[model samples]
Target: MSGSGIGHDQWKTRFGFMLAAMGSAVGLGNIWRFSYVAGESGGATFLLIYLFFVLIIGIPLLLTEFSIGKAGQMDAVGSFKRLAPNTKWHLTGLMGVIGGILILSFYSVVSGWTLFYLYQYVTGAYWTEPDGGFGAAFEAWTSNPVAPLFWQALFLGLTILIVMRGIKKGIEKANNLLMPALAILLIFMAVYGLTLDGASEGLAFLFTPDWSMLTEPSVYFMALGQAFFSLSIGICGMLTYSSYLKAKDRLPAATVGIGLMDTVFALIAGVMIFTAVFSYGVEPDSGPPLVFIILPSIFEGMPAGHIVGIVFFVLLTMAAFSSALSLLELPVAYVHRTLGLTRKAATLIMGSIIFVLGIAASLGFGVWSHIQINGNNILDMMDNITANVILPLGGLLMAIFVGWYLNRNQAINNSEIESPILQKVWYNIVRFLVPVVMIVILFISLFDI
Candidate 1:
């Protein structure tokens, strides 16, 4: 029952496992980046392509990650080592381990920004009418060296504390509350948003596809990236969580459920945000700025602006928190198992290191703005390097290893699904479609060719 010599904890219930996996999948990327990317990539067309990729690429890859962890019952790196001892396949897990740490470093920095904005909303700072508008307010907040670092450290500390508590008490329980509450809040926002003046236009913008945009290659590339990123794949977060699962636990159901729920959450959040954006008469293609700069203005102009602002930011933070927990867990699980450190000790050590890295990311926004790698700031560089380079590469290796390296019978047996036909479909996807699509996405992401 232990991947390493040390015993592991099982999720107390089936629902608990689902909640944890879903929580990991549904993160800030789903709500914030999904909306903006969908807008920039041609609205409904992007949504269609994204879902297609999720079905073909994301779900199959998700099952591959789950099977690896469940079958090996180890942390990401050890999972590979256990699955295929005396082989280089374990390098995929190593990449995932490093990618997890890298992603969380910048991720916590942005999560910290969410916390700051949540505080601003609670204090009526951003809700009240401002002379320079929400854009200026966001600039002022993000550009402040001390405040951003404080919030980043605070968020990292909170994430560390949760991981310190171990699986059942910490990760499972938090998701049980957070995911459902997030869903309710998002629905409330969407319902309210639909009632806004520009609801028709917003819905049209979201549901109506611009056919010509789909002809471009970049749309497919971006959709593929979004599908992978939105599911929290390629970073070993899913693999880490699934490692704690019991053998009897059915992975295919979990995989499909998580994939569907995560995509649904993003679509719901996208519509909610777009409704507000269209209502405010602003362009939806504002990229990342749409969340911080544009959304605040939308909230401020709405009825009960203060109340909506508070709820919105709170939802954002909750989403970020859930995702951050999984990211932190991957490296902590590795350190805990390999070094034989207590969960608390491993969490503290890894969390401290990540906090320090996060500090540099925070400073890159202001004090160290001059510091640039290949014309990108530290934060942007970390993001691009991980998302564009590391994640896809990890995913590519995973697809190849799971599809080709691992025995077909082993993967199907570990999946715990009874349907032979379904297993065949999953294997074909992992073997053929995923690797090819991932290569295209990776090349486009890195060289921009």
Candidate 2:
């Protein structure tokens, strides 16, 4: 079963398959970004809209990516070329490859913070009662570019090592344990959080809809963007992951599983964060400050603070690694499939390149402040380019490819199951709604409020 033959193969089991897919979908994007996006928008109202878009837009996009990749049986670049045949549509896959590498260059830097903080938790650094120590520690480290660079390299190396170990032995095995641990840790956090005095208020904020937020044009656009990013659509991870998937598996079922799992992570992270933040009476809109500054300070007072903080960051670190593993795999899979490089050689080259480029992203807080573009730091620029630009544009291009270019119904019929009506509805949504939604959101993201 484990024989190597250019060895492009499916996941070993349904459990392994679920862990890999869910691991890709659940990440820092769910914990930090989802809470911030929800907090920045009108909380529950935005979440509801985001969920709606996730069903209509995210699900179809996920299906298209899976079906296309399964059809091509190759990574992003190779797969696009196979499906499109001699046109520039393949470049969309190139954009996805580049975007994955570029995004992870900064993403790993942030992930390092979780790992760093976890060590601090074990060492009791965050629980020290010095005034402003929490923010001060984060600020001082980031202000020194070399510290973040070192940590980013550490995180990158860890991910590369796992990928080099082969899918089942390394990636699947680690995530199987880590994903369950993360979910359990989150449940513990939520239960602990509910005991705090402000828990009820936070729940209200998270669950109650503030429909008037819909009156603003940007709110809708923000919801769409969050939905897209949260579900990991147009990232090439899904496309690449599915290319290696078993041909006989149902694409729609896998997409649904991924979507639901992604949503679960976000909701659970919300509970974990709200409990801590509202308990401290901290403002939710403190932006990135909430995670680094507030959480540390809150941890100072909690019983068994060090142990809890350690577990929390462990959850974060696992989430980060799982997502990073998928992203790094995209280009390596492409190289192996197209240029015929060994997986090891491809991983080393791609990982090394990403490590070097990542220094600039790590430096953004201090030495590279002058290098800002559009008043955004290196991280912001990378995220905006990937999230607001490449992804939606990728999604738009994918919509065109799947809807106009591919015989999507045949694609659907090939993997068809019991629900012909649902299949037809999915086809229609991908055909009409997703492209329309992407266009509107892209327009708003480009020029509007």
Candidate 3:
């Protein structure tokens, strides 16, 4: 196979590539979404199942994406095209590019919310709660129509600036800094949270399992979905990142590192958030409002609450920003590779278009609140379509392409699995197990079953 004509920018080191991949995997899905989903899904029971899925399913798929990218050495779409010339396999990569763009559009809007809260904490503005408290304050701000747009633009602009600088200097350097800061802040908060009065209850809630809930099929489905989404698999972000790696870099070790870090981060976030919630006597299953609404109220009453609030939002924003970099990079890489644009030009054009698209989602909370698709607002609809439909389908096709269609010897070589026994285990899981699970997830998500 011939290389894509565009010059490839490689990761300066294996450590840099691992951090970038972990940054892509460890985002709002782990911190913000994971908390609420676990709360509603039966806490420790869901965590057990989620761990099962991550090990049995997530790591295998992660390795699959890494193998494809390292082997093809191109942008997501270009990789498939180069690997399987004249076939429709590239469509899977195209779907990933589109999914990345759409996910970033709505994703930036929420990330902007984190920035808003962070700013409020820094300025001490949150100390003086609005008339009805943080809940009302959250509602009023989201419904303002204009305020959210500014934050969204600012957040997306930051992402564009980082990605525009190219791989090593921009994306890798930023992750090296942001990810460590995020980890420290998270660990500090979790430790502090454990010292609170309700720490015991929070631990119980998170660690105690309701084994009977295992009988409910939805628990398995939610775990499967969370495992897939949290790792940022099927979006081509991993594929694009891994393409920068040298052939000597170990794919299996990197996959394990990214997966382990992401899962451990989510568990710590759960401990941090839940201990605080239980301490303040707030409802654990507060749904989406838990972060923006409920947390502020709880913080207001805590000792040195203002400082803690600032740290929490900072952690949240860093997590979101790190992930957003990968999301934006996926499309930027595509445009640069396939369209023959310079990296700067592709970043500018794609970043600008995504910012414009995100305005609709920002407005959805306010001016466009009445507009609904299948009972979901614009932002929710975009998230549902991409997360529930596009990502799963992309993942399914990727599994089939790599597991069944790609040359077996090439796949094995790309995976870098030295042991024949381990190689067979990974291969059969990707070939047999992943496809079956993905189909079940698609069925459950589509029919709302």
**Whole-model lDDT per candidate:** 0.84, 0.78, 0.88
TM-score of 2: 0.95
Candidate 3 local distance difference test against the native: 0.88
Clashes of each: 0, 0, 0
User: What lDDT tens digits, residue by residue, belong to model 3 across residues 1-449?
Assistant: 24533688988999999989999999999988899889889789999999998998889999999888888889998888888999999888888998999999989999999999999999998966668889889889988888988999999999999999999999999999998898899899988888899888988988999999987778877777688789999878899998988878889988998999999999999998888889889888877668988788888888898899999999999999999999999999999977889999999999888888888888888888999976678987887677667766777788898889987787788788989999999988889899997787667655656
Error of 3 at 189 (Å): 0.9
Q: Report the error of model 2 at residue 70, Å.
A: 1.3
Q: How would you encode candidate 1's per-residue C-alpha lDDT over 1-449 as one tens digit per residue?
A: 44443757667877898888888888888877788788888798898888888998888888888888888888898889988999988888888888888888888988998998899888777877577787787777777988888989899999988889989999899889998998899888888877888888888888888899877777887787777778888878898888888766788887889999998888888888888888889998987668988888877778898898898889999999999999999999999988999999999999988888888887887888899976678987887678667766777788888788878887778767688898888888888988887777667655654
Q: Tell me the deviation in Å of residue 128 in model 3.
A: 4.0
Q: Where's the lowest-lDDT run of ten residues in candidate 3?
A: 1-10
lDDT tens string, model 2, 1-449?
A: 12222668567665676688789889988887778777778678877888888877877787777777777777887777877788998898999999888878888888887788877777776667556577787788788967777778889999999888767787788788888887888788778878877888788888888878877777677677667677667868778877766655666677788899898888878877876788778878776546777787887788877777787888889898998988898888877767777888889889998888777787888888788877788877887778767777787788778777778665566434359888778777777888887777667656864
**Which pairs of residues have clashing backbones in candidate 2?**
none
Off by over 4 Å in 3: 1-5, 373-375, 444-448
For residue 33, give model 3's deviation from the true position in Å: 0.9
